[model samples]
Every structure is written in C-alpha cells, then in structure tokens.
Target: MPRTERPRAPARAWFTGPGFAPAPDPAADPAGPRLVCFGYAGGTPSVFRDWADGVGPGVTVVPVLLPGRGLRSEEAPYTEMAELARDATEALVAAGHAAPGARHVFFGHSMGALLAYEVACALRDRGLSGPRHLFVSGSRAPHLYGGPDGQDLGDDALRQLVRDLGALRPDDRVGSAYLERRLPVLRADLALCARYRWRPRRPLGCPMTAFSADRDPIALPAQVEAWRAYTAASLLHRRVRGGHFFLHGPARLPLLRELRAELTRTAEEREPSWTH
Candidate 1:
C-alpha cells in the first residue's frame, strides 16, 4: 500500500485575535509614544506587564501577546519568523497603534528582539511610518540566523537549555509534567529561530540600540555588535550585568532608565512648535 499522509493543520493566529490587549491603566494617554514589546521564546506579554510602572507617565508599554501562549494558549504557535512578523504588523496596525505621525518605539528581548526587528522592517516596507527607535535586547544580529541549532534537540536537551538560559530556577521542580507543558511551545520557537533566513534589505531609518548582557553566552559581544549594519541611523550597543535573561535581574533598573530616557527624548523631539 502507498504511504499514508496526515493532513496539514489549519493556520492559527499568534495574537489573541484581531485586537491588542488594553493598556495597563485605563486612564493612560492614548496618543503617547507607545513602546510595543515582543518577549523571548516561550514568553508571554506578562514579562513586560510591569514596564509601565518603571516608565512612569507619558509613555505606554504595549506588550504584544503572541498566540499559543498566555491568553491565546489554545491557538497554534508560529513556526516561521515571517509569519510572526506579519501577524504582529497586522495587529499593531489594526489596533490603531501604528497610525501615521504617531510616536512609537519597539523593544524586544532575546527571540523577541529578532521579531521586533522584522516588524519594524515590515512596517517600513509597507510604506508605513516606522518606530522612533528600535531597542533589541539579548539577541544576535538578524544576518546570523543560521547560527547554532537547537531545533532537533531531544526533550531532555530542550529542557536543559531552557534551564541554562535562566528560564527555570535550579530549585524548581522539573518533572515530566512541567516539561510536558512548556517544552512544545519552546521547541516551536527554537525551530523558528533555527530555520530563519534573513533576507537583505535597505537599512531602517530609525535609530537602533542593541542591549546585551556582559556574560551572555548565546548573544555574544560580536553577535550583538553586528546589529550596526541593520540601521541607516545610529547604532549603539549597551551592556548590562547578567546572562541571557539579564533584563529580569540586576540589569532591570538600568534597562528601564535607558528605555525611559529614549521615550522622553522621542516625545520631546516630536513636540509641536507652539509648545516650545
């Protein structure tokens, strides 16, 4: 008999749906510079939920919740970088966050950094105004997509990598139950990174900043520095203390300070002539 084949799965969105989640506070300024964020693999928007508190007033932190996790847990996750970028761009535009002349910024950590870069590029390609600044944290330059591979790792290796990346505490339980619940999603994200192929494109006009941890093994210094080629504007690399997930540790304070400073600067630059 001929070999049997399984049917292809239906396409599922990575976002909750056609809309974005509500801002942290109901009274937040609707027109302020929006800091749209994408989290690392197997990560949720909750990781950035508290950013608004540190950023204070004027800037709103809009964390983009990827599907197959968080509130959209029932949906299937995206296995390709382009798919994720397209979904994010559509969601941002549909939610009115990318309106012309609106002040906007993008911040992505680890895997999110790559996604954010693509989103910025996608918006620019569509003839839409891009962000004021792009902040990419804990990720290598997009051109090095074919770096080390982790997609084919077995379950044990996959869990180990996550733990090594600081996603899991040493004391926390890591029985089959935990792995069973988290590994699949993480594996999908790794696959996306592994299979990614960065196509050459015009450098973005927006200023780009790359954040890296001094000791991060994955996003090494050289890899971080490679981000310079992606932007036509200035490219600055700032380092903090910790490993891959430094943003959640001691580096948190300084990271927020930098973010706030950029937000403030952008807002000031865009101020109306009458206000001066």
Candidate 2:
C-alpha cells in the first residue's frame, strides 16, 4: 500500500487586530510622520497620553497597546519575546503603519525597547520598510538584556521590587488594590524579558537614539551605549538626569523638546520640494 499524507495544521493568525491607537490629535495631518511609542513592562498606552500634543504638529503620535492592559485587558498577555515581536510586526503591516515610503519613528522604554528592536528586525527580515529612526530608552542592548529575577519572586516580593525600582511612589503601598490588580500582568511582562535570547543579525540601517538616565539602576549608561553595535547607521546616546521612570516626571519636558526637534528635522527631509 502507498503511504498516506497527514493533514497539516492551519496557520496561526498573528495579526489579531489593530495593535495601536490613533494619533491623539483628531485633526492631525494624515500625511505627517508618525511617532510610534511602546511603554515599559505592564504599562498601558496612557504612558504616552501627553506625547501627541507635546511633540507638536506635523507629527502623529501612535501608541502601541499591548495585551492585558487598557482596552486589551481581556486578552492574554504575551510571555515570549519572539512571539510578541512576530505578532507586533504582523499587526503593523496589516495596519499599514509599516508600508513602504511611510515615514515613522519607534520609541520604546525598558521592555518596550526590546520589543521595538525585535520588531524592527522582523520587518527587515520580511523585506519590509522599517522605522526611519529607532529610539530606545531605559534598556540595554539586545545582547546584554537581563534583569533582576523578579518574575520568579512571590507576589509580595515582586511588588516590593517594583516599588524599589521607582515604579511606585515612595508612599504607595505595595499591597495597594491598584498594584495588586496589575501584579499578574507585570509578572508576565517580566517573564517575557527574562526568557529572551538574542540572535545575531545584520545591523539596522536606520539611525538610532538611545536615552540613559543617570540614576537608572536597571539600564546603566554603559549598557545603553552598547546599542551602537546593533545599528550600522549613526547612534546618538543622550544621558539625562533622573531614574528609570524619568519619562514620567519633570525631565519629560526636556526630553520631549529634543524629540520634537528631531521629528521636525525628519519631517523637513521628507517634504517634497518644488523647483521653479
């Protein structure tokens, strides 16, 4: 008798739904450059609430919303770096955010920085156009990615770890109802980072800007500077004053100012000129 072939499983749909929110400005220019943002572990899109208007006009701020948070709170959160990166890349393509000739920049903090880097790599591997500029904040280079084993700790211990890292205010109780509610999500996010293993690839072609905070224990200046090796294009390392969560405090204004300046330059470069 001839051998029979077995049925194959259906391909997984990586593009589940829209992965990002619209620009904050209702009247934002459709043709303007986009500033795509991704936040830290267990963070919601609200982290970038003020960025839309803060970056000024001519740029649209689009925040990437991860699962298990905000409106996506019902969805199961991703706990693997590769799977999340693949899904995010598919979502961006389906949403037309990564279309050829589209001008956009990627900004991510902490765990978000790793996601942004992986997504950018995925796009390149698929022969898709990647971000015009890559902005990684409060994260080490992909190869050097490792953190405290917070994911393995108990609920109480994990809560205390985050609080000590400045994720919670000094006065905020570790057992607060709000923190308790987000604890699981935070654990899963931390696990995603812990399990990541870096693979070598060609350096990214787009320019990169890395931000390091003076008081950030997690991502030191040396670690942030290591990002230079991952990009063939120019790398600009900006050392700012504050802790790991500086983007949320008084230091945010100056950071935004610098970001605005860069975005303005990018917009001007992309503008079509008419020669008379």
Candidate 3:
C-alpha cells in the first residue's frame, strides 16, 4: 500500500481561531482602549479592515474572526449565539486583553450585534470586566430574534436572499462564486439567529449605541430603538443613509465618527493627558 500523509496545517492557524484572528493593524498601546468588533453573518474580519485608519490611532480596532471562515476555514462554524459569545470572552482572555483595568469597547453588525451583546453579558456574568460601550449596527433587538425567517431556503431562494442583501451582484462572477462556497456557513449563522432565545438578564451597565439604516428591512427604526432596553446606561440610536449593508463603503464615515468620538471621550476620561 502507498503511504498516505496528512496535510499540514497553516502556520498561522494557532493565532487565527475564533475571536483572536489578527486585525489589519496589530499595533498596541497598553493604555489605549480596545475596540473589539464582530462582523455580519458569513463575514470575515476584512469587514473592518479599513476601519482602523478611519478610527485614528488612539483606539485599537480589533475585528474578530470567527471560526469556519477566512483563516479558520477548516474549522466547524458555531451554531449557537451563547457558545459564540463564551468563546469570544475566552479568546480575549487568552490574548491578554481581558486583564484588570483594561478598557475595551465592542462593535457588532447585524448578526454580529447579537453576538456582541451576548459576549458583553457573558463577560459580566463571569465577573470579568465588560466593554465601556457597545455599538450595535444593522440588527434588531436580541429578544426579537424569534421572528420567522427562511433559514432553510432552497438554493435559488438562498441565492436570491443573498442578492437582496447586497452580498451578490448580477455581474460579479467571481464574487458570486465566492458566496456560493460560503452558503453553508451563512445558512448556519442565519439558523442560529432565527432560533436564538433571548435569556433575560440584568441590563448591562455599559452604555450602548445602535446604528440603523434609514430604510433597512431587516432592522427598522423601532427594532433598533428597542436595543435601549438592554442597557441600563444611556443608549443612542443613529440613523445612517443606506440599506442593510450601509457600513460597507463611503456610507461608513458617520459611524466611524461616532466610534472615534466615543473612544476619544473614554481616553480623555481615563487619562487627561491623552491628546485630543
């Protein structure tokens, strides 16, 4: 019989797991607050790749890379929001950013918003420090996840749904092919979101900001406003001008300004010497 050899794993696999994947810019300042970000369904950390420059150098934008995508493509995707949140919390600890006095913020988009909220809760439940602020974009309230959605659509319907959400275009052959390869992961994430049961817990102490598109079907103005109930502190809702994927291109500047301003406020509060 011919000898069979197992393929070797990628060199960076060790650092590319859930929550700990490398951000576009890995620069660190022990005193600077960390902005941990989560992407939409089936999204990679690349969603926030260009955000670091826009956010300025005072805050470190850490775009989380979930499993079963990007560098961890070989790994299985998570099917539950709680499990994902727990893993995110552990990943932060493993990365040494969860230490005492560490200032951190969280930002999540669409399905990522739900994951970020749960993660903040998980951190608080564990007696660990939580983010100073939570920014949720393009998602409804967590408790409203029980709404009916087509998580088991046929191939054509699924593709149509993807197209409707602006993830696919009529003329982008390569992009279409890439989305086809990612459909399974996308379906799993959608199923998880549809089936999520929001467990009632004490509202988080951290303030929250919800960003919604002026006309997003997935998340209407009322749905986004409902997120205020999850936070005991102040909750600000901002309406941007675009559809569901508004944060993708030039439409992202307004949200960036909010992130930068809030981060600057936190920095100045912590250390008055922090330059504006």
Model 1 has an lDDT value of 0.77
> Can you write out model 3's per-residue Cα lDDT over 1-276, one digit (the tens) per residue?
994443433324424644443432345556576788889987777777777778887666677777778877887777777777777777776665555677778999999999989988988888988888899999999988964565789878887877777765346543367878888888888888987999889999988889999868899999999998998877888888888988765569989988887777754473332222
For candidate 3, what is the TM-score?
Answer: 0.86
Tell me which of candidates 1 and 2 scores higher on lDDT.
Answer: 2
**lDDT values for all models:** 0.77, 0.79, 0.77
Candidate 2, residues 64-165, lDDT tens digits: the string is 877787656676788889888887887777666776776778999999999999999999999998998899999999998655548889987888887878
Q: Provide the TM-score for each candidate, comma-separated.
A: 0.86, 0.85, 0.86
lDDT string, candidate 1, 1-276, tens digits: 994442222222332432334423346555577888889987766667678778777776778877677666776777889877987887777666777776788999989999999999889989987888899999999988764468789878877787787876456555556556767788888889988999999888888888889889899989998999998878878988999988778798988887887787744563341131
Candidate 1 clashing pairs? 14-67
Candidate 1 total steric clashes: 1
TM-score of 1: 0.86
- Kindly indicate the candidate among 1 and 2 with the higher TM-score: 1
lDDT minimum window of 10 residues, candidate 2? 8-17
In TM-score terms, candidate 2 sits at: 0.85
